[model samples]
Target: TGACLEKKRAHDREIHLHEQVEKNYARLQELEGQRDGLTYMIVHDLRTPLCSLISGLQTLPAMGELGADQCEVLEIALAGGETLLGMVNSLLDVEKMESGAMKLDYTLLDASELITCAISQVSDLVLAGDLTLVRALDSDLPFFEGDEDKLRRTLVNLLGNAIKFTPAGGTITAAAHAGEDKQSLIFSVSDTGEGIPEEDFERIFDKFGQVSSRQGGRLMSTGLGLTFCKLAVEAHGGKISASNAPGQGSTLSFNVPIKPVQTIAV
Candidate 1:
């Protein structure tokens, strides 16, 4: 009878420990949610001032005939401000998407028009980097229903990522084609840059995940670009991925259903 009583006490202690573990886990999740809310508020507040700064910088060029040096300096400052604003907006959008608060603004989109517009937006940067921008889109890309602005931003983000790692004289190609099933369209951005390590293929999509460049050191970025791209694609009922080229560089691709069967609450 004493041995049986000792066994019962041991079982009670195990149950207590399990209950404590569950409580701790729940508290950890609650703390994380509060931290995320705080961060979102801070980032949201930053957008207003950033926009005003960028607007002031934009007006300076048209206000008067600026000297060559002044114009160059203004351009650089404006670019930086715009980039920061983009990062802030991305952080907010990512939060909304993760919380299932963001809704898709679906519309009929022309594949060629979408690709062309995205390329045009980044063409100046591509040219400044001494990089070649190639278009490998299929001729028969059909009209698709999706959020036009978000999809364009996704392509731009992918192309921008390519431009960041690609060396001078390297090539960055933007390609689009229908999937074999004809139910979706696949878009890819491939760059002839330092290839990604096989280990980082998935991690790169995580928030704030950065990878070291083979050129020398760690690549500088907010690292939310790919995360935004991933969320945007998945919200369209699609999938995104990264892969290495045979000899060098890497490709980032995503497929959006031609007719989305369901909306992702992500």
Candidate 2:
């Protein structure tokens, strides 16, 4: 009876691991962040040219009457090149943001615009996974002072994580509401997925903190992601947090000053 019970528990754990792994981001942001390394330098140097090459390849299909075989090869090249370029850029962003070296360009920007741009970027990914994307914008919200680019990046990361974590037919909602104090805005990204354990609410946001999906094997942790999100929000006199949602899934929310009193360094 004891042995049978243990076997049943092991089976249940395996099923849970499969679900978590399925929810993981397929975009593969697992780039090793090794600055001052030859590999990093090479990828750094290749980004610009690879981007240019991808662009050029994109134009060829439209500009010329190429054979089907030739067009297929071009398509493959474009896909592979873009993947490499994305990884290169991801590493750079993580390194710069983590080091607190990148300067922010502060502006009084419409939160609506920031939110829309981010949704647009991640919408295709959400759809590809057959997940529903929901948006809830606070009406007549006051304009906030912050870097549009950085804010958009933060939104993208949050939404991207949602898209990656939710399974087919699941819902991922991005919502915002103004603070009662009239000095801040609250933003949230919630998804229907394997919810976080109550104890991990704080640890997940720590740098390099990891979650394993299966035994003796590891699933890429969301630790680096929460780390980056926390830093980005805090850099603007804001605070970020994570918690389990009702029924299932996790909600990551952050509060930002409506008008950031601390000037963001250019």
Candidate 3:
């Protein structure tokens, strides 16, 4: 009788502990949801004013001719504003993507043109950073049907990351080629920066994930860029990954199907 009573008490305690754990987990999820909602609202609100500021900056040159010094300063200001606006837009899109509220706008897109446009967008930044931009695109990349804007932004985000971590004189390469399957195309951005740690290969794509390195120091990122890239790529029925050789550099790559099995509207 004593042994049976003891066993019963132990079982009761175990059940109580399990219940407590479940309660704590639920509470944590609720808190995280609330935080995400607040963030989405704030970031969404920032878009309008940011657009107005960028518009005014754009019109400044057209308003009148400016001195060289003033023009250079204005250019820097506009660049900064545009960069900030991009980050804000990324935050909103990430939220929409996570919530399955975003839709993919499929279009007939030229792979080479997409690569060239993406490179052009960040050419100025690449030059300013004293980095060399290498284009390794295959001459015969086939035309694909996908969301052009999302794909372009994905490339830009990868290049931006490379530019941020890469030191002056480093080379950043944008490459694209037909996948062996011929049903997909592979695109990659590689940088000769302090390579990412093996442990961070997956985590770097997580929301708000940041990688710290001995040589380059902590990455200065809000960490949403790669998350957005991952979601965008996956939405097109594709996958993304990161890899690097020790002491060499890192590459972030993704593949897109020539035609998605299904156009996802989420």
Best by TM-score: 1
lDDT of each: 0.92, 0.77, 0.91
TM-score-based ranking: 1, 3, 2
Per-residue lDDT of candidate 1, residues 132-227 (tens digit): 999998988899999998999999999999998898999999999999999999999999988887778888899988776666776645289999
Better structure of 2 and 3 per lDDT: 3
lDDT by residue for model 3 (19-107), tens: 99999999999999999999999999999999999999999989999999999999899989988998899999999999999999999
Candidate 2: tens digits of C-alpha lDDT, residues 1-266: 99999999999999999887866643233433342355547767887888788889888868979998997898789768876775577566556666567777788888878888999988768878998888899888888888787678788878877776677999999988899898899989999977666666787777556654323445556635566677778888898888886767989899889877565432
lDDT of 3 at 189: 97
Worst 10 residues of 1 by lDDT: 213-222
Q: State the local distance difference test value for candidate 2.
A: 0.77
Question: Against the hidden reference, what TM-scores do the models get?
Answer: 0.95, 0.73, 0.92
RMSD of candidate 2 to the truth, in angstroms, is 13.5
| Candidate 2 similarity to native, TM-score | 0.73
